[model samples]
Target: MSLFLEYVKIKIKDFFSYRFTLFLFLLIDIIYIISLSVPFLIIYSATEGFPNWNIYELFFFTTTGIITSTLIFTFAIVIGLDITDKIKDGSFDLLLLKPVNIYYHMLIQSLDLRNFFPDFPLFLIILIILYPLVGILFSWINLFYFILIIFISCLIFIGFSGIFISFSFFVPHFDSFWDLFFSFREISRKPIDIYKNKFIVLFLTFVFPFALWNYYPASILMGKIDTSIVPSLVLMAIIFLAIGFFSLKYGLKHYKSANG
Candidate 1:
């Protein structure tokens, strides 16, 4: 944890040293947020409300998705893509020789501060806007669920992204895999319950557990479901944990130095 703090301090120091670069990163973060949100904003503007969820309630889903995606982007880009770059440039072998648990080491590695920093302001704005709509239901338990769900979603994001990048060991230059991975992750961004097809809703919810990112917890806060959320979350935590650990071990075994 001290090491992680030092990494964060360095990021802060770098942020000051390169003000222009930091500004550009912040600008890019804002633009990316706007781009991803415009379609949802348009839909809300046109209809004024979704079928099952009102605008304010849907904001929960929207913010949840944004938060999770930003987290995933930061985690995956910092670690997965870094690994990819090193592998391509023949520098990854050095990383493999570091005397530590490689997976655990990567877990605490430096994070992209800008990736989720901008989202904090937007999240504050969402809370202000939703104060009236959610004030009545804002109890301690609901808040606990909200925080727990967000934390678990981040873990899932990390695990899933790590698992996908693990494929890089077996398939060099796997450009198409990233396309498919992101496409599949896109499903986690929307309110899956609104779909007409119940099977898909169920699949994404309990089966693949994509809904755990936003939809399930958002709906839970809205009183859409009961205690069933417990087992579903437990199952998801297990699945992602296994995938994360298993992928790290398996992928590391296939690792060959650039010289080899």
Candidate 2:
């Protein structure tokens, strides 16, 4: 645990050492937030309401989705870059020599605080907007569901990222992989409810599992779906997490040192 903490500390120090780079990344994130929110705001205003949803409900659902999307994006960029760079430069060898698990080491090395400043404000703004509708007093049950949704969302995204990054073992060029991954992010940003087919929803929620991140919880909270989906989401997260871990392990076994 101490070693993991040390790795996280080192990662923070390294990120801060390039202050200008950090600022640029944060600036880009802020721009992205505005770009994302503006469309939803415009559409909501133009329509006078979200289809099948009132103003307050739309605000709450959009906010929740944005928060989860932001967190996923943050982790994906941090973890993806760390893995890609290490594999490219062969620095991953140094990490493998450590007593700690290599995946854990990679995760710790990817930790960055820069994402918080931009994302947290957006998250808080959403919360403030929703407070009037949901009331200041939160039910413990709702809180539990909220936290669980966030946790599952993070796990599902990071797990998918891990699976993507592990492809470095087979594919020497990760630039294309990253491009593809980011393309998928665009789809994730919107509520999956836009897809009308029940089969598509089932595939996204049960198979890909990204829908569990924000959509499932938001649907339940907004009274669009049943609370029963919560347990299923948890199960899907665990299954995908396991699949990701196994994929990484398999990739490691096949990994040939760059020198070879």
Candidate 3:
């Protein structure tokens, strides 16, 4: 635990060390957030009102999606890049020699503070805009479901990133995988309801777990979906977690270190 804290501190310091770089990243993040929200904003304005969805509900989904994507982009993407370097330079072997779990170490080492800084203000802005519209009804059932949605979203994002990074162990060259993953991430920013096919939803929720990230919760909040979907969302998150861990473990077992 102390080691982990120290690692986090070092990461924070590293981030502060590059002020210009940090500013550039923050700028990029702000631009990305604006770009993501614009389409939804345009659609909402064009429609005057979403067929069945209200402003509060739209805000809920949009805010959650932005936060989820921001975290994934900052944390997961950094780790993905680091995985390639570790595999190439044999630093991963050095990590394996440490007392801590290699994956945990890698995860901690990949931490960056710059990505999260912008999200705080943006999230606050969203909350300020949403609170009056949604009202604090405090429904226990809704709260439980909301928490579950957040949990599942985090798991799905982490699991997807883990699977992507693990491919480095087997593929050696992962540029194509990275490209495809980025493209998928871009697509996922849109409301999942945009996809009309039930099969596509099933594939995303059960097979990829992307639906839990923003779609499932948004649907529920808007009253466009049933509460029964929560179970499947939980199950999907668990399944993705299992798959990610096992796949990474398998990849590690096959990793011969560049020297071998």
Residue pairs in collision within model 2: none
What digit string (tens of lDDT, one per residue) describes model 3 on residues 29-88? 678767766777788778875555565666677776766655665666667677767776
Tens-digit lDDT track of model 1 for 122-232: 665765576567543666776577667767776775676667556766677754566665675577676776667888787776555667667766666666666457666
**Model 2 ranges off by over 4 Å:** 6-30, 74-77, 97-100, 133-138
Q: Number of clashes in every candidate structure? A: 0, 0, 0
Task: For candidate 2, write residues 119-147 as lDDT tens digits.
Answer: 66657686677867854355567667776
Q: Quick one: ranking by lDDT, best first?
A: 2, 3, 1
Predictions in order: lDDT: 0.67, 0.70, 0.69
Evaluated at residue 247, the lDDT of candidate 2 is 88
| Per-prediction CA RMSD (Å) | 3.0, 3.5, 3.3
lDDT of 3: 0.69
Per-model TM-score on C-alpha atoms: 0.82, 0.79, 0.80
Best by TM-score: 1
Q: Is candidate 1 or candidate 3 better by TM-score?
A: 1
